[model samples]
Target chain A: MTATLPGIADIHHAATRLSGLIVETPLIESQELNKRFGGRILFKPETLQRTGSFKFRGAYNKLSSLTEEERSRGVVAFSSGNHAQGVAASAAMFGVKAIIAMPADAPAMKIANVRKMGAEVVHFDRVREDRMTVVRPYVEQGMVLVPPYDDPSIIAGQGTIGLELVRQAKALGASLDAVVIPCGGGGLSSGISIAVKDASPGTAVWGVEPEHFDDTRRSLAKGARVTNEPGHQSICDALLVAEPGAITFEINRKNLSGVVAVSDQATRQAMRDAMANLKLVVEPGGSVALAALSSGEIELAGKCVAVVLSGGNVDFGTYAEIMAAA
Target chain B: MTATLPGIADIHHAATRLSGLIVETPLIESQELNKRFGGRILFKPETLQRTGSFKFRGAYNKLSSLTEEERSRGVVAFSSGNHAQGVAASAAMFGVKAIIAMPADAPAMKIANVRKMGAEVVHFDRVREDRMTVVRPYVEQGMVLVPPYDDPSIIAGQGTIGLELVRQAKALGASLDAVVIPCGGGGLSSGISIAVKDASPGTAVWGVEPEHFDDTRRSLAKGARVTNEPGHQSICDALLVAEPGAITFEINRKNLSGVVAVSDQATRQAMRDAMANLKLVVEPGGSVALAALSSGEIELAGKCVAVVLSGGNVDFGTYAEIMAAA
Candidate 1:
């Protein structure tokens, strides 16, 4: 039996809920990219979003959906990356206590940003222990558990980007032939594909993943969910999810045109291009869509395309090195 | 005797000329500073402005004012900093070739950015010879010389920020007690002071300068233009203009309520506070307003103050080091 996934109605509600919680980041047309690619290219700069990532939409939507009693009790989550920042900032705004379980090896900058948002950060070894194991007790103790991706509200919230894309594209008097999205656990892509297909109808949606961690790409071909082997690796730390969520996978399989795989090197090049041409700081996972475009993994030589820059919360010292290499 | 500055009519024409050439940078409220000072603090974040500085507004205005014959020939300027970037980008937009002479000691990144904007760069030894000496031949050959400041159109274009300020403050339903602006050659402060005072009558305007490079302050006090000793000095590379321009000084002496000075140490602290609290990369010169706030030089404990974040175009390497030190 097919389970119901997030649809446009849910997405619309979540968008309304997340209205003030997230920034309606601009969808800017890149003159440089347009000149490089034959057709026009628009970039949705979510890097300027609250907490520097699109994850804030989902985080805030999930938190706002909670009952007052649950909110009063607090919230818990497992993330040391953009999701951590998202949850911390969202919880702070809601005046709720947040406990984030992060890998012990998380970057100091990430930890500091989380703490600055007033979240209590708990560290554990991701290689040795499961993060979910630590969060189960907190969930049992009445704290609402805001999962990073595997929830309807979260998916619906992320789908708001798709809504914005349609409106912005229409405003620009451009019909997008394709929309390329960076995928982690498929939450963002699933929601985006559903909404884009619903709103634009003719626009093709493509999800991109790093080749080293191509679980979603492989799973889509097999018509089922699949998990990566233990040794799978990628420099795109944020896209290192070993498997796609069941709900997200189902939605993506139905609405997405196809999944594209990009190399780590291509992602790096895309990140460099974003910094040089777009004057933006995009993280590895965030640049996966551009990686697909730049590396010719997704053809857009004669078609207008929208590439979502998912996040820009880069570590301080790493910015110069990235720009220098470019 | 008081000199008449550009009126609303002149500024309106400048704004009309510059509408599409420059970014309408956001006027965002500083939640942290507002809470700290017990008053509203709106920051015009020009760090995101094209070429990473407000210099572009003035530069573009100056270039746009050139006659068709002058535009067809080309333009020349001497700035190893934001003015160079601004002139380069603006000239390129106007389809005019730009020849820029810079000090040999200028940052590699700034030089590269100018080159990337299609401007021809000529380097000289500022210690032994002035940049104008190197650029004079180009100007003599009928190429229009674009001064970094000390031009009517440039001042009027920079004044657009003040127009925006009045509108933004009204939107917030708060009357700003004072607007503190950073002074380099006083182009920005001179332009803004006139516009702000005109648009929002009764609101006071203040100019800030680096302690070691208080040429504007000195000039105002002396009732005449003054110049500093030419040598290595202030950390604010952008604000080390030895003297206020003649035209700008006359405007400032009339419109400004007072001038305040901030130490190099205070500038560094403000830069740190900006990065840590606001997640922004502000150069020493860009941090002068915040420097005044943090050093208690503004006496704005319970008054609403508007501080302009004048620029954002610092080299990433410099940013990392400055952030580390702060």
Candidate 2:
């Protein structure tokens, strides 16, 4: 049986719960970007969030809601980097121990950052090992498992951003016609869609994915779950999910307008443009929504738009290569 | 005689004038940074400003206040990059033509950005030709000269940031103990100090500068105008002023608690730290105030402090070089 999904009411409760815990990241507008795109583009930069990503919102929401006994027992989770850091940082805040199973080939900076947040790391080979198997021992030891995108609490936590977006946009007297969000497991997109649709029913929600790993796009089109081909490679390490989460996919299917895919090259260009115009550091995954907009994949010439910059957890070597190519 | 220096009243008027024209750049707090520095550090990131710098505030304030006759004749100004873009963009908003005199050796990206804003550029040799000499023809033809930091209107415009800083901090329930601002000719520092001090009389306002070009520091100590030694060089190209501005110095001399100088190396490190932690692209000059705090030049162990990141208009080549060294 499928678990109960999060709704707008849950997101509002999460917002109240996370009032002082997480950063209310700014909704910034760039005049140069507006001039180039021919629309009023507002950027919800979660790159400036607590762990340099929006994953912190869900991680904190899930961990803080556990009972006293569960909190004392600690928690286990699997992620490449962003989710690992989010879980680790949230666990530390709640005075709970975190055991994170991460891919052995993950960016060194991300690995280092996760450890720096006081989490015990269990590395798994991405090609040879299943992350769930690697973390099964810890979960069996009475430690609760914290799923990255499948949990209702996690979805509700991420939905807080959607709520903030509506409030901030209204404060600026802007009525958005569409919102573009970067997608991995569809948790962020689904959560944001629920909140945005509830608050501004007239606004359309769009999800952007990396071209090579566009499982969500296929899933949405087919009206069912779809998996990506094995061994697909992309620079967007954060948005490399093989399939959308079961619970998140259900909500996204109902609320999302459509899903768009952007190429790696386009993502790189968006990163450069963000650095030059927005003065914000954006990782490949974080640049997908912007890439779609700048590459003309989504059309909103005269309308107001919002693009969510999901995260900024890139390494120096990767960042340098991107800047050099530009 | 120096023109009358702008006061709190003028800054309030400037805030009203610039209501929706300028970005209210986010005052962000990084939890990791707070942990490392052992204090609360709020960052006023003007790197996210309209022209990627806070210079836009003063430039817009000056241009929008010009008489109808003055607007018809257009405006002339000289700057390395940030101020040029600010002037060009602001003049364009008011439908006034702008002629900018820039150094021939300025960063190619900066020159290209200035041109992209539709301003007519006249190049001057920094060592041989005076900037004023290059723009004198335009000035003689009845075009108004928008001085970078010396005019009262310009100071009042920049002072609007100080007003925002006080309001944002109070909203967060944080009472700032000190505010460290980057200093060039003391326009930004003097303007912000007036607003900050008037609102929070107990807060200490400190000006930070490049180690070699510590003219403002020297001037503050001498109780009169003092010039830096000629031929001194630093990576902070935007802060190479030899002496403090005439009107700005009067406000700074009376309002600033003290001035501190940071090394080029420290500024570079701060830029790297900002990229890694804050996810903000900060230029060398913009990193000065942050440099002072990170390098222990400012004793802010237990205090709540605010550091203003003044600009982020660096070229890719220079930015890459700085990142590589880190």
Candidate 3:
């Protein structure tokens, strides 16, 4: 049986709930990028979002949806970085306590930012332990789990980007030919896809993933949820999810035109180009959509495309290292 | 005789002329910065402006001011980096050729960007050959000189930021107590100062400069124009101008409340902090006003302040090295 998924109505409701609580990051475009692509290229920079990523939309929505009694018990979240920061900051905003389970090797800045927000952090060896296993105890203790991309509320929350972008693109006199988003568990991708499809049905929505970790792509290929082999790796720590969340996968499969995977090298080059041309500091995962465009994975000539820069939470040393490489 | 300088009406006219030609770059603020300063801090990031700096406003204004016959003869500009890129891009936009005199040691990216816009570049030894000497031949050949900051049109063009920020701040429900600008030849500072003082008389407009290159600060102190010593140095390549322009200095002396000088170390720290918290790629010169806030050069306790990030054209290698340093 097909389960009911969050739709445009839920997304609109979430937008209302998130009004003034989240930053409606401006849709930006560079003249050079537009000229290079031979088309209008619009960027919705969620890098400028609260917590430096789009995760704040879902985090704040989830927090707002919590019962007052449930909030007292606190929220538990499993994240690589951006989601942890979002939950921590959102919880702090609402006077709710947050506990985040993060990989030990997550970028130092992300971890420090989470701690700075007064959240309790539990570190797990990403190679050895599953984040779900780490958050089980907190769940058993009556804390609401704000899964990164699984819940309907989170999906609906992240879908707000799709709503804002369509309107913003219209305001800027651009009718997008397609929209591309970076994918991990497909929460942000699927959420945005659904809204984009609903608002502008002619526009195509595609998901991009790292070459080494293409669970979402493979899942779409196989017509079902699939897990990645244990040894795959990439610098996009935030997008290393082994598989797409079941709820997000179903929506993504229905709404997304297709899924494409890109190389770390390509993503790195796009990050550098963004620094040089767009004046934005995009993280590895957040840059994958832009990578897809720059790497010529998708044909952009004569077509206006909107690419979402999902997050910017890379540590200084790591970012420096990326930019320094030839 | 007192010279008739550009005023609010001139700025309003320029804004009208530049209606759709420029990017109305959003004013950004960081919640983390607000907490650190114990007050609201807004950032007008002209780093995202076309050509990656606020210079575009002035450059485009100058380009638009040329008569049809004058436009056919093309334009010439002398700059450290940002102004050259702006003039190049603006000239290209107007379908006119440009000849730029740039410092030999200007950031590679800036020079490349100017050439990319189909402008001719002539490099001069910044330590020996004065930029005026470099551009004198072009002006003599009948190319209209677009002096970086000295022209009345340029100051009025830069003053557009003051109009935008004050309106944006009020829309965000913030009443700014002060506005800080990164100063070079004082065009942006003095221009913004006039507008802010005109629109919000109670608001204090301040100019920030590198410790060793604070010509505007010294000029204000001595009640006349002053020049920096040749041996003094800083990493703010875009802001190494030795003296304020005649027109700009006059406006600055009348409008600005005060000027402050910050150390390179402070500017570097602000650049790093902006990358981490605001997810922005700020160049050395673009970061000075923000540096003034972070370095505690000015007290921000219980007052709302606005800082303008003037440019972002630092090469990736240089930026990476800055981020790598302690």
Candidate 4:
């Protein structure tokens, strides 16, 4: 399975192909964060993306493979959040219709944003039945099914950030000791680890997961896919996937240096730090890498480190609530 | 006066010298804004600056020019907002002690931010007495007075953004029809107007000011400085300067093509639009250019336009108030 996966070269090609569609968001040095963490920390702010999330990169890449004739039929994706906006926005860019299947309990802000992007929203009860079941009809109706993760195109697209990180570091003449990536279904981590290792072999790549929902960490330790139906609650809903993808697990197991888990308190504090210091509005899922740094889950004594902020799709009200909660 | 004044060439040299002290924020293309304005619009997001404002550039540039003997004696500035943070942060970088004189009525968030930057804060009763009266002694005692926008170094540093806009536009092989710049003390507008006109003579530079504080507009029309009382009401405190600086007014009047004024309503709406569409938290002063666009005060029919978002130093509690007002 590891041998079957595409490496850094494939990801680099995807990045070049998807150039103008995705923004090369600013990689900023955090002066406040450096002092707080006792070492230098650079942030790759994907919150400033076209759809306010790095999901746009993977979504755009997946849609670019479709022929004009196929695009006319449109695309369908099952996400109540960032991926929905990404798919809808990428489809809109292509002048194609997008249908989004969302949970009945999806945030109003998320639904409004998806509709604003010209996507037709179809609601389903995720607790009662599988959302994918509702998405099948759209696929059968000649619509392409855009998976949020667990797809090669998505993984390869995310790996592009890893290539960008290495290039950015070289451009700034900053040598990184580590690059911390947040792990959800592991598509981003798997892809980024491969590219980071390939581009800077001496730089270690660490995956950070919420302590409560540490599926990737467990999966890697067990050397197999593991499910977490055990009610371990995490505020980071975006990174609460039940298990790691089979393809992604194989890549992460071999490529990632290690996996680190941070407490929910650490995640919330990191979110506050990001807003106050970095002037970024990162969702809890996106701030997991920073959480790892703050909690000493990853040592940053004398080394420069870069953290990928996965997305900024948190609703403003949700952010207010999270800050209040913190 | 024009022959004696420094133009784009001198400003360009200053821009090159001050590059590392400032963040080269993105001049992003806004699809939503283009659809509304019937033309392309580039948003230069200076909200992502070191102190959440472009003032850092000017502050750092001024501090960098101090003699070794003077640097050890320290620096002082009279500001209750972004300028205080800028001076404090920049001086701290150079290991210089900074004493900031702030109004007692200044927002707690701003005061806290300045204090966190490791500067000594001195409270002044702006309601009872003049802040400049207190600043005079500090300057007399050999402490440098870093005027918010009335100094040469400050204007030269801000002109760098205009230089960046030209380079960024040329890189894309696109030419700007007009560049919209926000005016407070006219430092940003005056410097930018010279740079833009010199680099691309075809591009017209327009200055935007809040209607409530139209001293700059009045002064330009009267051919003399028009001083308003400190009570001129404006949500944009950063732009509530009593009058345009002498040097800034002379250059702006000679170089700027036009001046546009927008209401507080328009400014608030622009802030909402930035949050909702661009996922940015721009302060009131920062959103004035967008306000001018949305209010139809500045026409952009089929033209490529750029607007500088001067800063994003708004307090979180006040953000809700601004949105509610909108």
Candidate 5:
């Protein structure tokens, strides 16, 4: 069966659903940082989003699309990071019971945060089993599954950011030469590309990810989906997804100008600069596109660029260790 | 002399003049913090403003009001902090020469920042002479003096924040019980009170300052203008002004619902919380109102409050120490 992919109109519909429901994060810029890069770079910080990431946009939208009977049966998501919190919070808002499946190796704080939102946490063994195999049992038990990035509704939901970015950039009287977005499972980048490409066809949309977890970059280069090596290490925990979703990859391949990768060191530098210069706390995964922009992985001279700092759900100790290294 | 003060209409006019020039900063709120405080607390973080503070609003407005002759003669400001940067940035924008007078003991980096924007810096002996006496020579040299917080145009400019806040809060479907603002020389609080009280007359407007430098609070209590002890000290450096401005006091005295003070410790804690929860970097002076709100210094149960985190110009070293101590 062929499903029509989400488009700008769907994104507009998502914005209608999300109106006054999610925080309209601001587009911020720094004079010194912009001067250093020899360009004007506006940043959309979704760290201010409820649940500390842009994932909330998609999570709430997905839940909002569910039928009354589906909602009554409850919802479940399989993730250990911002998606878990987004789903948990959205479920609580809808007064639905939610079961969040996570790797047993996930941080205690993350699990606690999910539980704090009144969601049940089911632990999966990361060493032997993947989240899908573990979450299948719950899905079979009458609970509706909320896919992190693959669903059409989820893509449309995240695309609202792109709609907002285009409008905000225009309001600032800025002409966007390009837009850089962090790509984990490709939901955010792909959604944003669809919206931006429709609104400003001249603006190039680039997707950035960490070095070893550059599955999206490799996949785009090969014109096919490719998986990262199962055991690669990087500090950008949120972006360590194995491969791009089938639906998301299709959208990205069509709308995105290119996909790029930034080193862990550059990612940390971007995170540090966000704190010192931009006065924002960005998680490592959220800073990869910023890393690429600041490090000149992309040529930015005399350009007006927009970059997304996707989240801020980092632990203090990890953030301190990174900053202290500076 | 009986000069009329600026009212809400003046603020609306200023907002019109500043529509595209200034950043219409978003009103941010932390879900976790709101739940903990037992009320919704919206933060207008001017830390995201141009030159890293709300002072830029007033500085640019004051510069815009200057006659062409005044522009040709250049401008001078007697602030060692945010106001200096605001004036320097505004002057640079207008292609006008600017002189920033600071204490001899002011941070070298601050002096350098002003100069980097093509402004001249003059050092004054704080122990022997005040900034006014030291800047008189430059004023006599055909330079226009840009008052930090006392002028009617400056107050009207700062009042733009109040207008933005009222509109944003309404958009969020929130009815504010009171609005708490950081009081320095009373320019920000007094200006905000005029705009907010006009728009939401039933909503109380309270000014918060540092404990040792609580001249506004004391003056409100005495029903007359008063001064703080010159030798007292506090960590809220930006708010350490000894007394409210002559023009600012009259507006604050009549319009403010009340005035209060927060301790240095509470201020530091608020800074840390802003970083951890709101993902924002708030300076010592900027966090006073947040400090009061978070510390329960005011009756907050079941109330919807709006607080301003006025600025974010803290040295990372100082911020590190506070976060580490936590």
Candidate 6:
């Protein structure tokens, strides 16, 4: 049976549910960036969101929808960092227990933050072990599983950002020609695509991925699901998903304008530029959409564009190294 | 002759003048910060302002109000970095010529950005040369002088942020107990003090300064203007004013709750914490208000507080050093 995807109405309901619960992150415009790119570029900075990522939107929406019995039983989730912290914080907000399965080599800061948020974490070697195996025991114990990007509720939740963006743009008396979003499992892109396309049918939605793991790009081009080769390396740990989710891929295939892939070096350069120009702390994964714009991979001259900075959960050591190199 | 300071009416007018010219920055709240401090804290991030600082507010207000003759003759201003960039950007926006007198040792990025914004920059020796001496020729040539923070229009412009905070807090269904603002020449603090005090008469307004540059704090305590001892060093170069402004001090003396001083070490730590928790890039001087709260110098435990992060024009080298040290 095919998985049902969340539509515009579900996203609208999610927007209502998320009011005051999640931050309505600002749509910021940079004059300097506009001059350089010759486009009116609006940045939807989820970096400023609670837990420093948009993952909080989905996590909170999903966790709050659970029945009283399910809330007491708790929830299990797996993420490298951003989603892990999102789940931990959201669970704590609803007074539910969260067991997070994270990779052994996940950023130390992310791991510490998850624990600080009162979540129990189980670490697994990403290279040698499957994350699901570690979380299976918790799921067997009747804890509900909160998938990072595959669930309909999660997609609808992230779509709330798109709703806010459309409303904010209109209030500013501006209209978007296109919107670029960082893609991992295609959840954020697909969700935003549906909402933005419905609100402003003229706006195109594009997904950006790291060069090393362009599974979503390949899948979108081929009109089928695709997987990345193992052992490929990238600094964008957050976008290291080997393939798009089954449900997410279907939605993205229908709604996305196209996909763009950016190099690790380009991502680093975009991070440095963001620090210098936007005064924002964005992770490498979160910088992909910006990288695509800055590198001219997406031509947006004289057009009104919106780029979503999906997260900012980088460690000091890694951030320093990147800034130092630049 | 005594100069007249702008009042609440002037600030409201400035708010109307700056409707689309300036960014109405968001008042951000962090759950992690609230948990650590045990109080609701609202952060007014002027770091996201046009020139990465609130200096733009004052500069734009002053520049936009110039007469046609003054605009044709152009304007001259002195600043270390933030104000220089702000003046340059505002001048460019109005198509007016700007001669910026900046310190030779100001961050290279700031110097380059001033030039990139189409301003003519004249470097001076911060230790041996008075900036006014270099700009005397321009003033003699009929160009108007724009003081960084001493003028009524400048202060009135900065007060627009205060108006926004009061309105935003009301919409959020919250009221502030106190507002802590970073002190440089007292322009931002004094201006915000006037607006916030008038809008929310019950809320207290406090000023924060770097430990080495506690002129404002000492002045408030002594009930008279005081100067910092020369040759003292601080990483908060933006707040290195030796003494508070003549007009600014008079206003602050009457309206301020008090002034608090934070060590450079505390400021650095706060910058790191801001990057980690808030995902915002704040400079040393800009982080002082948050530093006061983090160091427990402001006593914000159980009271709703608002802190202004005034700038984010730090260079990568300096930011990397701080991050590496942390």
lDDT of 5 by residue, B1-326 (tens): 23668888889988987877778888898888888899888899998888778999999998889998888899998885788888999999999999998877654445666788889988887546788988898899999999999999999999999999999899888988899999989989988998888989988899999998889889888987788987777878688786888889899888888877889999988987887788887888999998988655577788899999888877656666776666
Model 3, A1-326: lDDT tens digits are: 25558889989999999998788999888988898889889999999998999999998888888889989899999898999999999899889889999999999989999999999999999999977899999999999899899888899999999999999999888898999999999999989987899989999999999997899989999999999888878999889988899999999888888888899999999899888888899999999999998766676999999999999998888899988883
For candidate 6, give the docking quality class from DockQ: high
Which stretches of candidate 5 lie above 4 Å from their native place?
A1-4, A103-112, A123-129, A324-326, B104-112, B124-129, B295-297
Question: Residue-wise lDDT of candidate 2 within A1-326, one digit each (tens)?
Answer: 24498888889888988898889988888877898999999999999999999999999889878998998999999999999999999999888999999998888878999999999998989768977899899889999999989889999999999999999999999998999999999889999999999999989999999987899899989999999989778889888887999999999898988999999999999999889889899889999999999766677799899999999999877887788776
Error of 5 at B87 (Å): 0.5
Restricted to chain B, the TM-score per model reads 0.95, 0.97, 0.98, 0.94, 0.96, 0.98
Query: Considering only N, C-alpha and C atoms within 3 Å, which residue pairs clash in candidate 2?
Result: none
DockQ agreement of candidate 2 with the native complex: 0.76
User: lDDT of model 3 at residue A267?
Assistant: 93
Per-residue CA lDDT of candidate 6, range B192-300, in tens?
9999999898899999999979999998889889999888888998998878998999899988888889999999999998999899999999999999997666667
lDDT of 5: 0.86
Candidate 6, residue B8: lDDT: 94
For candidate 4 chain A, the 10 contiguous residues with the lowest summed lDDT are A317-326
- Give candidate 5's error at residue B108 in angstroms: 6.4
**Over 4 Å off, model 1:** A1-3, A28-41, A172-175, A232-235, A260-279, A300-304, A318-326, B1-4, B28-41, B169-178, B202-204, B259-284, B299-305, B323-326
True-vs-predicted CA distance for residue B154, candidate 6, Å: 0.8
> Model 5: per-residue lDDT, tens digit, A172-284?
88989999999989999989998999999999999998988889989999999999987778877778788999999999988888878889999988987887678888888
**TM-score of candidate 3 against the unseen true structure:** 0.98
Ten contiguous residues minimizing lDDT sum, candidate 6 chain A: A1-10
Which regions in candidate 4 have their CA more than 4 angstroms from the true location? Answer: A67-72, A230-233, A323-326, B1-4, B323-326
DockQ of each: 0.23, 0.76, 0.81, 0.37, 0.51, 0.90
True contacts kept of 3: 0.80
Q: How close is candidate 6 to the true structure, as a TM-score?
A: 0.98
